[model samples]
Target: MNEYIQRCEALIQELPHDAVRQNEPIYKHTYTQMGGLADLFITPTTYDDTQRVLKFAHRNNIPVTLLGNGSNVIVKDGGIRGITLCLKHLNNIEITDTQVVAQTGATIIGASREALAESLTGLEFACGIPGTVGGAFYMNAGAYGGQIADVLERVLVLTEEGDFLTLGKDEFEFDYRKSVFSKKQYIALEGTMTLEKGDVVQIKQKMDELTIARETKQPLEYPSCGSVFKRPPGMFAGKLIQESGLQGTRIGGAEVSKKHAGFIVNVDGSTASDYMNLVRHVQEKVNETFGVMLETEVITIGEDLKDPVND
Candidate 1:
């Protein structure tokens, strides 16, 4: 084995046997079923374990990648190098009255359900967001006039230097699908959501209504990274793409969703390259027609594309 691979294996032995894996396929962990292999994939089950792995990587000068539920991201075909940490095993939820404390790995939908069980009302808007608590907090995810910023009270995070810290709501700087987390190298550990007590029937009705709307509007049957581009100022990205006549435009295996022009879906064995090309094409067309530059909301990682789209 090479020196780096040997060191990775030695480090894996220090963690729980089942928690660490070598050359694991990253495609299985993502929503779009894309990506190559990760040289080292660690599924830490506890906060301490997460800290240990991060510390080890930091000391060894190894690259570390933080991955949540893999909803709003695209992993390149060349995959990721070094340690890719997945916190899915750290999932835990607790409710005390109108406050909900959720680990980073817990799904936002799961947290919303816990809120519904406790008859909390504010999280009904998040029941349909397909991401983890950490991912939601990282992006300030929102829909239907409700956002994580409206309910989030505080968050616990581990900084790049391995210090644990708690940040209050005001410190988060939550805006349209953005947070201060985007600017910092801190990893979210857990979040506390403050909600209001409401009638169970009313909350369930709202959640159900939003769920129906999502099913009717989004291309749920296909694999996608969810809303490829951010809303550009006063304009909606989907409307602009649709107006540019770019809906259902295909590049390789990736196609803009006919149902929602904002989404790029894996129609037939699409690679990360296919998705990016389609995104660029739509951007060019929309810019040419409407003169608005669309910015990508989806996070792209790993090596550069081998076959890039031609202009």
Candidate 2:
């Protein structure tokens, strides 16, 4: 084995055998079913285990990447080199009256369901979101006029120095598809969301309506990184793309969804490059047509191709 791989394996040996995997395929983990591989993939069962792995990587000067549910990201074909820590194994949810405490890996949908079970109202807007609590908080994910910022009370995160800290909603600096977590590189460990008591029937009705709206509007049948771009100012990204005559535009296997122009879906066996190229093409067309530049909401990472396709 090479030096880096050897070192990573040694570190993995110190953690639970089932928790650490070598040369793990990242494609299967992502919503788009695209990506190459991770050099070392670790799934910690608890917060302490996560810290131990992070501490080891830090001390050894090994690079570390945090992944959550892989729902809103596109990992490139060249793959991630250092250790990729996926928090899926840390999923745990607790309901205490009007509060829901969710581990980082717990799905936001699952948390919303827990809230519904407890007849809490504020989380109804999140029932259709397909991401983990950490990812949602990282991006300030929201829909149907509600956002994580509206309900999130506080979050627990691990700092770069391996220390745990609790941050309130204000500290998150929540905004449209952004949070302080993106800039600070703090790994979210857990979060507590506060909700108000409400009629269970009303909560379920709202969730159902949202779910139907998503099903009718989005191309959920295909693999995609949800919405491709953030809303540009007062204008919607999808409307801009649609108005630019870019809907159903295809570059290789990736295509702007006919149902929703905002999404670049894997119509056939699309690669990360195909998706990225399509994104660039749409951006160019939209910019030329309307003087607005679209910003991507989907996070793209990993090595760039040696000879990437022209955008």
lDDT against the true structure, per candidate, is 0.89, 0.90
- lDDT of candidate 2 over 1-311, digit per residue (tens): 54557887767777888998778888989999999888888899988888888788888888888888889999998888888989998789998988899998999999998888889999888888999999999999999999999989999999876788999877999888889988898999999998999999999999999999999999999999999999988899999999999998899899999999999999999999999999999999999999898999999988765556663
Q: Write the per-residue lDDT of candidate 1 for residues 211-291, one digit (tens) a residue.
A: 999999999999999999999988899999998998889988899999999899998999888888888889899999999
Candidate 2 Cα lDDT to native: 0.90
Model number with the top TM-score: 2
Q: After the best TM-score superposition of candidate 2, give how far the Cα of residue 13 lies from its true spot, in angstroms.
A: 1.5
Quote model 2's TM-score: 0.97
The CA root-mean-square deviation of candidate 2, after full C-alpha superposition on the true structure, stands at 2.2
